[model samples]
Target: MTQSADEGFTTRQVHAGSDARAARPRALPIYMTAGFPFDGFDDAAAHFDQGDGFGYTRTGNPTVDAVERKIASLEGGAQALLVASGQAAVTVVLLGLVSAGEHIVCATHIYEGTRGLILDNLARLNIEVDFVDDVNDVAEWESKIRPTTRVLFAESIANARNDLLDIASIARVADGHGIPLVVDNTFATPYLLRPIEHGAAIVVHSASKFLAGQGSVLGGVIIDDGRFDAVRSGALYPHLTGTGRLGGSSLAERHGGLARIAYLRETVAPRLGPTPSPLNAFLVGQGLETLSLRVQRQSENALIVAEWLSTRPEVASVDYVGLPSHPHHALAGRYLARGNGSVFTFTLRGGIDEARSFVEALRVITHMTHLGDVRSLILHPGTTSHVRRTPEEREAHGVLPGTLRLSIGIEDSADLIADLSRGLDASHPPLETVEAVREESGALDVVVAA
Candidate 1:
């Protein structure tokens, strides 16, 4: 079916990018050839000039195109580009935008991968990046924007911590500056939230995560709203506004509102060689076929897990936005109406030793660094993911000594609770402390009057 904007997410997920008018295979076929055959010299010359038809896999592929359509449809985007990895997607976007001596204002609540890419990797290219301490503070966001600031970047739902980004507010800030607001919507997949509808100019996803559902294929996707006008935005994006290389028309002049994404597809992604394999693209398509189901299940299971953990004596705090106790629950209610994502971090009652015991005692939940899988995964962020961050930086970001991040999956809640029970038991306080707490507390839950 050629997708309609009116179609529900699940319907579109299953049928988008398919042409019902054409007789084709029910399943998406992998166009595995390195290059497509041309009719003759004239046809080849025409293909080179016309630029729509697929000529080479590195620049374009049928299987990859189909998957890109599905993703763009799902994300409510004008176009999508599938790349090699999530990091590649960010790098491609950066290459498309900022040049040397420019600046990017980003949120500190983002994943470590992006943080490193901006602070460490991008710095090498002389692209300055600054992080805002609070994503909810529009004033703070505005304060960081400079004349050279090219974009505003943040996560819809931050990884590990589950902090919510006030996308509309930040987008307003970006719009005020005549710049685009780029949101990493990996955690809160399009099944849950479409950042574009909330005013974000662009959305990117680590398709390897929830979009793939399984911990298999390594892929990334970038989606644009196709509303950004470089001409209207003044001179912030000269790459899109000025004459193109070889003295051709500028990107915006050539593609109108779709200039940025077109640049990424035609120049940044292909030139950088971040194109995915046909088989990998096919794998991503299969994952997309069940995107809603897997993410919904994970969201539901996550709420259950969060509720159970909150009442545990071994757990000091749960950083899930779904919980009313979260500092930003109101933001979650306003933005993530469907369900809070599954990835969240919580701290143990004790320090790193207790967290280690809790992690090592887990049986059903795998202790791994990866997330957005069919199986529940656990990891200690302080030591595993953010070990490079200074002690003050980690603590400032709420990564306590005993913090453990959980990416809940489609497992039975009871079984997950059972595995966590063993971990809690191993990490439980000493006998004297338990006795003192029991004597002092009299409530069944946190009320502590039982």
Candidate 2:
């Protein structure tokens, strides 16, 4: 079925990338080949010169292209590039925009992988990064922005902590400095928020997470709004404004609005060789078909779970943006009206020992680090995801020894609650405490004496 540009999200998800006239394969077919056959020398020459046809899978693949188009449509962006992983997407976008000696200002709270990439990998390449301790503080973000700053990076909804970023405000800060705002929308997904619509220039995703829904594939995408005009922005991206290595003209001149995306696709991603497999791309597309359903159910389940945890005597805190007690609940209400997303963290009163016990006691919830899976998963951020950081650094980002992250799934609410109850009882030993109370009251002691 043909889809209109104005179709609703779910409708677009199902039909946006479909070519009804071409073979009518109801599902998107995987073009799992390293290279495609060329018609002749002329065709090969044309493909090379214009970068039109998919002569090599690394350059492009039909299956991957379909997923890219669907993701672009979903993100409300002009173009999207699918890569091997979320880390690749970050690497390609950064490399595409900046050279060695340039700078990036990023939100402090983000996925540990991305934090490591900026501080370690990008640092090794001479690209400096400054992290904004408070993303909501426009002045703090602005203060970190240097003349060499090419981009402002942040996540739409930060992982585990559920710190909701003020997208429009940050985009404004980026624009004031003539830089682009690049946001990782993996946690929020396009279902909850479209960063482009909120003024972000580039939106990235870890398609392995919520996008794929089933946690069966590793993929990533960078969606360009086609708005960050390098030529106009001036001095921010000399790579784009300068003559291309392929030797015609600058990317800005050649691709205009699509310069950044074109540069990444033709130069960065292909040369770096982080191309996603066509099969993985196909799985991501399949996941997109039910993105709305899974995310909505997961969000609902997370809220229920968060609320339940908040009331428990053993819980020290619940870091869900959906909760009224959360610091970012108002911001969440403003931006994430659809839902607060399923991935969040909550702390236990008994610290790491109880956290471990609670996780070990869970029967229904799997004890794993991965989020956005169909099955509920739990992990200790202090010991696992944030272990590299010092205690001070971890505490600054709200990752305490007692904190346990939960990726709520679409399981029945009652069943999930019951499972959590059992885990909490094991961790806190409420039954034992009650028995002690009864004995102190002489009720259990007298019965035992008789």
Candidate 3:
């Protein structure tokens, strides 16, 4: 009983691949085997020579395949591939698209981990990556394009700040240049916004985050919308377009619109060894079963907390798009139809010293570097995520010395606000500092009298 395409998101997330087995179990069974036995002689020959079935777990697995199908269905993608972690997904996806000497245009407002990957790791491969200052400006995205550029990548909702990218407008820019638009949908998840439906050619997610719900096991997913014409743009994507390395058919001809994902599945992921363990896949599947319920409640809680923080004297500004005070709230309205997402940044009134006090004073919210968890998380971006970035560069991306990023979770709104208020009260300078300054002034007057 394959799920109907007309099924709602909530329905699809839970029931998409539930009935694939002959006898359905209450929970999806994990095929925990590393290798499946071959039928012998001719069967093994067919499997090895023709790429017929799953001979090795590294190439594919039943548990991973089922989870991939559910994610693809949720994102309205032609196909999906699950990887070991979010970094692995981004690495394999970019490697599958661009070889050395090619270039990529990226948006500046992205996760700091990804920024490091693009700036340091990819640069080592000689694959140039240029970042656009204003991702909202189509012109800025276009201006970064070169003859060798192959992909335009941005986040659907940035992790550091809840920045919204104009997916359709940027997708149009990539279309004009005959390249694919790769969007990181890790923060928004599919419940909030599906980037592929808005004209993005490919969508990626760090399933370890909200998709995992509890931050249990690490996972990543790549969804191909199957719209990019890799075959048509042979000159730009010769690797995907040229004759197959094994001498049969090119990836472009074999998979058509989904050549990029096929290239990853067959070539990149296998060799890179980013295979997801069946147990991890099962954990992530468990998270997906309740994605809508968790994400919806999390968004509501985030909005309530963001609004309350904005009114406090200890807060200077908030970066959540749900707040009208945000500079990109209108863009949020146009793109984020469901909710603006739960992760955002806020600036403490004092500098790094205040941020330290606030983090130390936190009782309910955890002060960890992770986000999109079941428990609320807080971190000072300047000292943590964006620490590698120079002070000027960090400031350019709104990571001020006083700025703190929050990933609101499914906690009670009142509890979260109360905890934040406690942090605020502790963030201000201690009364002893004022008295110490006055005592120093009195000493100077006594010296003059002497």
Write the residue-wise lDDT of candidate 2 on 72-144 in tens digits. 9999999999999988999899888878999999999999999998888989999998988887999999889
Q: Model 2, 127: alpha-carbon shift in Å?
A: 1.2
The residue pairs found clashing in candidate 2 are none
Instruction: Assess each prediction's global lDDT (C-alpha) against the native.
Output: 0.89, 0.90, 0.88
User: Which candidate leads in lDDT?
Assistant: 2
TM-score of every model versus the real structure: 0.90, 0.91, 0.90
Residue clash pairs of candidate 3: none
> Candidate 3 lDDT, tens digit per residue, 1-450?
478889899989987875455777788889887887777788889987667887888998888998999999999999999999999999899989888988999998888778888878889999898988888899989989999999999998875667788899999999888998999999899999998898999899999999989978899999998765764677887878889656878887777877778888888999999999999999999999999999999999989998998998788889889999887899888887778889999998879999998999999999997888999999888988889889998888888989998989988899999999889878875579768979999999999999
Clashing pairs in 1: 442-449, 442-450, 443-448, 443-449, 443-450
Pitting candidate 2 against candidate 3, the one with the higher lDDT is: 2
> lDDT of model 1 at residue 248?
78
Tens digits of per-residue lDDT, candidate 1, 303-370, equal 99999999987889999999999988998888887788899998998898999889899999999878
User: Residue 147 of candidate 1: its Cα lDDT?
Assistant: 90
Candidate 1 or 2, higher lDDT?
A: 2
Top-scoring candidate (TM-score): 2
- Between candidates 2 and 3, which one is better according to TM-score? 2
Provide C-alpha RMSD values for all models, in order.
Answer: 10.5, 8.8, 8.9
